[model samples]
Target chain A: MDDEQQEKQHLANDGRQMTLIDQIIRNKVFNCRYWKEDCFGLTAVTLVDKACKLDCVGATYSGTGKPVPFLCLLMKLLQINPDKEIIIEFLKSKDYKYISALAMFYIRLTSKPKEAYPTIEQFYADFRKIRIRNLDGTFAIWHMDELAEKLLSEEIIFGISLPRFQKRWILEELGQLEPRKSVLEEELQNQEQEQVQVAEQQNQEKDQEQGQEQ
Target chain B: SDDGKQKLNDEDTLDETEYALWKIRELKRIKQFNDEKNKYEIEKAEIDRRRNLTDMQRIQEDFKLGSDKTKMEDKTKYV
Candidate 1:
């Protein structure tokens, strides 16, 4: 067969091995953390499983402690509601900048070409002004306009080559977006149709008044 | 009233010293835990990196060896 076919087979094998390793890692992580006093009572078994499968063994935690709960929370949100309305609402939140950043990043990953803009544009002004604690426990403010600009300008936002293998670990496991088209044009068309209808109704009323008066 | 004030002041001093001791112990325990955590993390990373390298090497070797690769044996084995 061709080199392309060989390459495709190689990739499939690579994916299969990766998942196998992922399952084993998940098993070890659960076995280790599940019995810890702090983690013993935690609920949401499915979310915890998803969180464990995330490759964070070597991740640098903040000064406070372990990695940010970004992955776990994102998993929980996706598991509970794939509609992403709750996550979108998180963007409007002024209280938690880190959570907002997670939401913004999620949008970057999930949004369709045109549907991205309006969903993200309003949050732009807010998040740029927001500050978040990094994984290293350092306080940092988001250059939100820079981030927005990056998302809008780039095609492959999460697939940057520098952090090669671990980029997948950093990003939330992608959840499907509900099918949506930009409704701006449709809304405008609807308004125009309503205006025409209102005009026709007004003319009819005027004609009736004239007939009655006559 | 003067005697009562003196007792209250003594109690305050004892409480302050006790709280200071608690803080010191707490800080020490936290530092030890973090040190242990960091050491465990380093160990885990080393183990993972080695495993990852082996996995990559094995995959590359398998690809290089090719699907048709098989052991040579006695002449009549396939027949």
Candidate 2:
């Protein structure tokens, strides 16, 4: 009983860690049923298992704004403060999209402007569909590219007030970030090359016809 | 419909919290169903539009158009 009463070693610094989530939202997550049961004592490893089961991404739902399982797991992540490598692994994984989204949401909430923009912009080419649970308990489909765009630009997503980061244009002006290249740049270049080739072929055909006539 | 409810087995010993989670998932499943239905309606509308038929002509061509989820019956719904 005495040992059980002792705070877990990993949770010793939770006071500082708890500041990651907003005060009101943190209280909601702590009081939520999912937090009490599913998120109890979850470490970084077990959290991955929970994240894989998530089908939709949102902070809360049902008009009442009950905290969703995704939000609870996010709060658990804030409490645990997993290593950067783990968070990166979650971001880079292609198999579990919800896990990647969870990582993205965490990065948007916690990372500095320098880190967040470049990290999120890399996923702009991912056009896969994602299920989003709206605040009214309705489901809406959003593409991964759309989610990435919103994360970089939108002030509020999923019901949480994101930490304000410097605008991307400002960062680019300071030469802190490279101007983001569009995914269609290569395709457009290929189309231009094809057009040039077609024009050259027409010129060659005309030259051949003129030579034949001469 | 209550068809979304899963039948429990004797081996399944879920507490109230776990059951609540299941209920939430059930609600999400119903929402997913509606989204799927809406997507089908949108795709069907796109195909119908591509067929180059006027709205009134489309309704006349297909008897089931009255029951269509695309709301062509309302006339102004889509515009």
Candidate 3:
């Protein structure tokens, strides 16, 4: 084969081996489960579709026109349905990292707008109340750290200061207490000891029964 | 003999054109197939990544429960 034919064959081979990262990105772009049917969700899907097309056409951006950050897109979604079933569905998806990333983007965007700064406290409060439902419709709560980074970033960007009481309450209620630091540690240890004792007693009883048999 | 040679050359040129056109069509087909495969792969990878994150979160929760059980034991002994 000529050099041109050889080059074409190599390109074809390379195309066949699509990487894992590419697949993950494509799923995010093409899949609708990450978004709801509301305005924010629709907008996000549209923006993503545009991004996919742009990527396909081999267009380069100067970074000035990058689509709204993922978090902003999510916030738009939240605005459309602050407490909708679709929100929980999106959260339940394995793509929580993308969702978290989008949450941070919204926090930053809102913080930057002077008018939106006043709403930060209320947003934080509402966020604390956000509960996700599993596929079976069971409610599942997410951790504070899942929220803290974005909340802190929003606070920093907006210059909105939360009350000390509000901060303490959220920290105490939402933060994941370390295993060693939890008050339940002693109780758990005692249970383990009791279990061991029960097992020993059962063994002794078995031994006596065997002796009787002998 | 010269006329026969000319006719053979024409046939050779026609064959080359046909071959080139076939190759071009094949390349287009390959490109379309790759595009679709890439799209599916991207969606699957995203789903798997999310699943892994959920699993990790569950494991962490189980560890927390185990620790809580230990703590309860310690408290009961002290009381």
Best prediction by TM-score: 2
TM-scores of the candidates are 0.31, 0.62, 0.23
- The parts of candidate 1 lying over 4 Å away from their true place are A1-66, A133-138, A153-214, B1-79
**Full ranking by lDDT:** 2, 1, 3
lDDT (tens digit, per residue) of candidate 3 on B1-79: 2232233221122255554553454444345535755676688787786577776675676577685455667777853
Index of the highest-lDDT prediction: 2
Local distance difference test, each candidate: 0.43, 0.72, 0.36
- Ordered by TM-score, highest first, the candidates read 2, 1, 3
| Steric clash pairs (candidate 1) | A62-A137
Candidate 2 lDDT over A48-159, as tens digits, reads 9999988777787775568878888887787777888999999988878889989988888778888888888777666555777777766666666678878876788877
Scored by lDDT, model 2 comes in at: 0.72
Residue-by-residue lDDT tens digits, candidate 3, A117-154:
23222232222212222223233343223244335433
| lDDT (C-alpha) at residue A12 in model 3 | 65
Question: Candidate 1 chain A: minimum summed lDDT over ten consecutive residues — where?
Answer: A161-170
DockQ class, candidate 1? incorrect
- List model 1 lDDT by residue over B1-79, tens digit each: 1232233221122255554553454444345535755676688787787577776676676567763235333434965
